[model samples]
Target: MESVSKIRLWILQEGRSIRSVARATGLSRNTIKKYLKDDNPPSYQRQAPPARHKLCDGFDTRLQELFEQDQKRPRRERRTAVRLYEQLVSEGYTGSYSPVQRFVRDLKRTDAGSGEAFIPLHFAAGDALQFDWSEERVVLGGVEQKVKVAHFRLCHSRKPFVVAYPGESQEMVLDAFVRALSFYGGVPRRVIIDNPKTMVTYVSRSKDRVFHPRFLALMNHYVMEPVACTPASGWEKGQVENQVQFLRGRLFVPMPAFDDLDGLNDWLRLPCEELANRAHPEYSARTIAEVFEDERAELRPLGRAFDGYVEKTVRVRSTCLVQYASNRYSVPSRFAGQHVSLRAYAGRIVLVSGQDVIAEHKRRFTRNVSYFEPWHYVPLLDRKPGALRNGAPFVDWQLPDGSLSSAMPR
Candidate 1:
């Protein structure tokens, strides 16, 4: 095609002889003459070949039906391409798996929505915040344990707050939000979260979200509107999602070691502040800390903090211990066999009776580990001094240098 076009141009435009054009272009004089005489250049057109046979020629209808049937089934129950191929082979379809796979792929491409389009979102300072939770493994007190990490991020500044928890219960979720707001010194006008069971109780087909009673109460206390993302649409709260991954890699990696969850979280404070002090990705002119500072003024004032604890009334056992979860916490011996209010906090358990805090202990994660206060049993030990030798709770009891051992024989 190039030679023909060039020969025609040389002969007609440059007034060169056809024989000279053929010599210069390495083409026959007759070919050059034909190109010169023709108005359009000669070009080749590829002719479609006749339809050929396919190994899975007659299986399209069956395959399409199977795929359509799968659309009506649950995701876990849907058949994979390999499974469908095996089934077809069992049904005497004499084709390789590749054909069946390709057919399924093409069918999905045409039948399913090709792809999703997302619009970039923007938020004003203190306008919105996103929250999420992720699981991480860390060693605490020389024991490896799995922990849930709560992540919070301001949408405008990308500033983040992260804390570790023993569980993802509703109480923990509310506590995370309270701690995050307190750390930031203010609250955003709106809170965005995924449709987790902790926050969302129901999601209608119209996407109307019904939040949990306690979660709604928290929002009401903060005076912030709660916005839930569509189910399975994590991109709606993508900021916190990315923050979770970032913390998992940067802070959680190497498996942090600490004496307790409180110490780990306290250690995390400096790192979180350092992360905020770094240069912002979108606004390079200022650090995230600076941006957050600007946002703080726009945010709602830090009002009284919410009492984010789970409270329950439990009967004190004969051992002067209150049962919560699967563990027991000790109270004063006088309160034995009585009911007391147990408030489980993020780091401690408080026992209250008649408006008085009867006892407090560090919250325990392991089961059947009784937290005993030797002072709580002082009166009982005074009355039954001989029992101290074989008392299970007093097995590790010790006395001060000036004090006589009660377990010793009189």
Candidate 2:
């Protein structure tokens, strides 16, 4: 093709003789002359279809088997063409990778659910809620950091609620639901969730899933059924998936900052309500807030709040401490050297002994630190009178002022 173009360029545009172009391009002078004389550029025609190579001749059945097996695996864990090529090499394939790569690419086009078509879905009022998590960057306490933000959407009304957290974990997930349900003032009949391991422990060969026990307890407490979306199917909970992007732009586009997560959440709460004032997407005549008002009656009454927590049993060490996440919190001295129930929430940790909250504290994320509720060590004072003055737990404790003490009961 380059020789053909040069033949005309030298003879026509550069004013060079056809003989010079023929000599430079290794074409016959007659051929150069023929090209220059034609009004349209010469086009090459294949005399016959390219010959087929037998490298993949015996591999069709094997390739199909591999492709089908891959289809059954989770999308992320599925084998790519490169991996397939490697596997074929180990299977004694003597062919170049190109044929195998091309085969796999073509094989995927015929796969089930490979089409672009999708069904439009509908939900009844209060039928379901959707949940998702996304990470956002914002200035927190003068430091730029990434925070995992939980998003919730009412499927029918299109009402959205969002909360920010330091991290996304099992306890954080449970707490987010509590906060969202509280914000909406009721629970929908069902909740559609992505297949996050924090909530869905196991997704079987089919649609069946083993919901994490704590997450199941949360759903049962609110009388709501939990539904897990199939892997890679965001459309199953498109409402919250869309909200994750929508709120990321609306709320964090400018890169918000706050003194703490709570302040950031407080700021987000108002805008959530304000956003509801806009007209609903499906019902343009009614605002989302108006639609939600209609949805409220359909939602189940907000019952007693679920004690959203992740519980673990831990033995209190002789130091009157129970360790969690590499940090320890003091329990009552009497419970020392005994196994107690440790209930961890997003913002707090509580030590419970047969329904008694023996100790509670603001949860800390720093590792290897100990948090002490000074009063928890009060019972130990009877055993050692001198310990209080030298106790590490009481180092930060201080007596009340005279004016404050006068108000306390004797």
Give the per-residue lDDT digits (tens) of candidate 2, residues 205-269.
Answer: 97789998989999889999998888999988887887776676567755788999899999989
For all the candidates, what are their Cα RMSDs to the real structure?
A: 12.5, 17.9
Per-model lDDT: 0.83, 0.84
Between which residue pairs do clashes occur in model 1? Answer: none
Q: Give candidate 1's TM-score.
A: 0.67
Off by over 4 Å in 2: 1-117, 378-390, 400-410
lDDT of 1: 0.83
In model 1, which runs have C-alpha deviations exceeding 4 angstroms?
A: 1-116, 401-410
Clashing pairs in 2: none
